[model samples]
Target: MTSRAPAFPLISATGEAMRRLGRWCCVCAALLAAGCATYGPERPGEKIYRDVVFAAPGGHKLRMDIYVPRQSKPAPVVLWFFGGGWSFGSKGYHVNVRDLTTAGIAVASVQYRMSHTAVYPAQLEDCRAAAQWLRDNGARYGIDSTRMGASGESSGGQLAAMLAAAEGKSRIRAVCALYAPTDMVELAQLYSKPGRLSLVDKFLGGPADQKLDVAVNASPLNYISRALPPFLIIHGEFDGVVPLEQSERLFLALTDVGVETQFIVVPGKRHWFRLDNTQFAEVSRFFQVNLKR
Candidate 1:
């Protein structure tokens, strides 16, 4: 969900911008982090690592918190991303993976460069780096690494889907996206509020109308392919922020390409709604079935 833009220093989109954005990102992250100070008491027999640096792109240190289950054998991992309209979000935001870890799955809540700090591919690149880091370092933390998946909401949802759909060696085995904007161009056009459109603008470094190529490049829908991993897409029935059609189109595109996918619309719900126990169970089951291979 988009919010009022914080005061950011004027910096050119260059090496210098990356450094400055890194600083600003920490500030925004700290503010958001305070809200998620406690995610319940730690589960028994669970191994937790916080603020583990996964990558340092352009001198910006990206981090993730890994929660490893107490399984004897190495367990599958799900890399989670957080949503903040690509402007500001913390790695700890909206993370609830107890079900996953309890089911013998590890969860890595990852942090990426926000749109206000960096442009489109930067976020993707940072996320990809996190995946690769997990692949390279997961063994040290009891993660299988071979069996990987991703899940996120809104903007983070887009990252998770794109990370899986985009062609790369680091692509995961599955993805679960919630109320994400799959089509950047459509999201920009559907914006009814002034601030909403600006979210797309700042993310793409300009208006989507002017940067059609960038907008297309940023869209997860355009990246759909048959080789992509299975997907579980959940959208609210009346999501005004990203709209239900966004997930619908992505589901259609994936299915058309012969990719395994499922679309579930939460009835009578709006954007920012939490999953009930049943819905959460479905998501947990989706990953368990698809990722355990």
Candidate 2:
């Protein structure tokens, strides 16, 4: 009881310290959450226009989902396609739409006829037509058609590459392909292992040996030239579906033809990998460099 007079002060000090610690924890948690939000797939305040018919091929309505950014003026547009090996996939499945839009870019997630519904050039045609539609109707959506870019993953990547390389009235200022098959003929040959041959064959409508011309026609490698737009080709090193060499060949061809290009080989990744913040930033920067000019 001799030192009891100071007990209240000690208890007050201890309570203050606990309060400070709790406040510090809350601040740290907030910072961590903000950091994670940057990389997270949360699309807030994005204006989405879904199921917009871009084309009607063979009586089928090819649609797209347009995600517009909150910008003062019209923003650059990036047309995105889904990967399904030309057999499966849709516009609803996209990764970086919010990230791109947040960076002042409008994103168009497109849909093309699958292999079960059509064939090689048919899918390519749908992509080209979608690009054309964006170019033609971009003004309505506050999009800068002249600053348009193309991007895709897997089979969608193939279509995106073709959109950038193939001849068209509207110009695709930049191209980004992720684990896509650049060379259909080469992919068909590489994936010729038993039970794998049907992947490419089904898309091409026949084997490479039987449909060599069609395969070449569908390959983005065959369309590379000096006139092509700047390209960023990203492929997984351990991709079993589309060989890494497909992107390598495309990168080599683009460089040999004097088209500005960059090839990134993701180590230890397979056909599909989760896109990190760095990859999203690279894509945003690539478009900003090529399109914002």
**Top model number, lDDT:** 1
lDDT of each: 0.77, 0.74
Task: Give residue 78's lDDT in candidate 2 (0 to 100).
Answer: 90
User: Candidate 2, 139: how far from true, in Å?
Assistant: 1.2
Collision count for each candidate, in order: 0, 0
Over all chains combined, what TM-score does candidate 2 have? 0.82
- Top candidate on TM-score is 1
Q: How many backbone clashes does candidate 1 have?
A: 0
TM-score of each predicted structure versus truth: 0.85, 0.82
Candidate 1 per-residue lDDT over residues 167-229, each given as its tens digit: 432458888898888988766654423343456667887777777898898899888777788
Error of 1 at 62 (Å): 0.7
RMSD of each: 9.1, 18.5
The whole-model C-alpha lDDT of candidate 2 against the native structure comes to 0.74
Per-residue lDDT over 170-190 for candidate 2, one digit per residue giving the tens place of the 0 to 100 score: 488888898888877766665
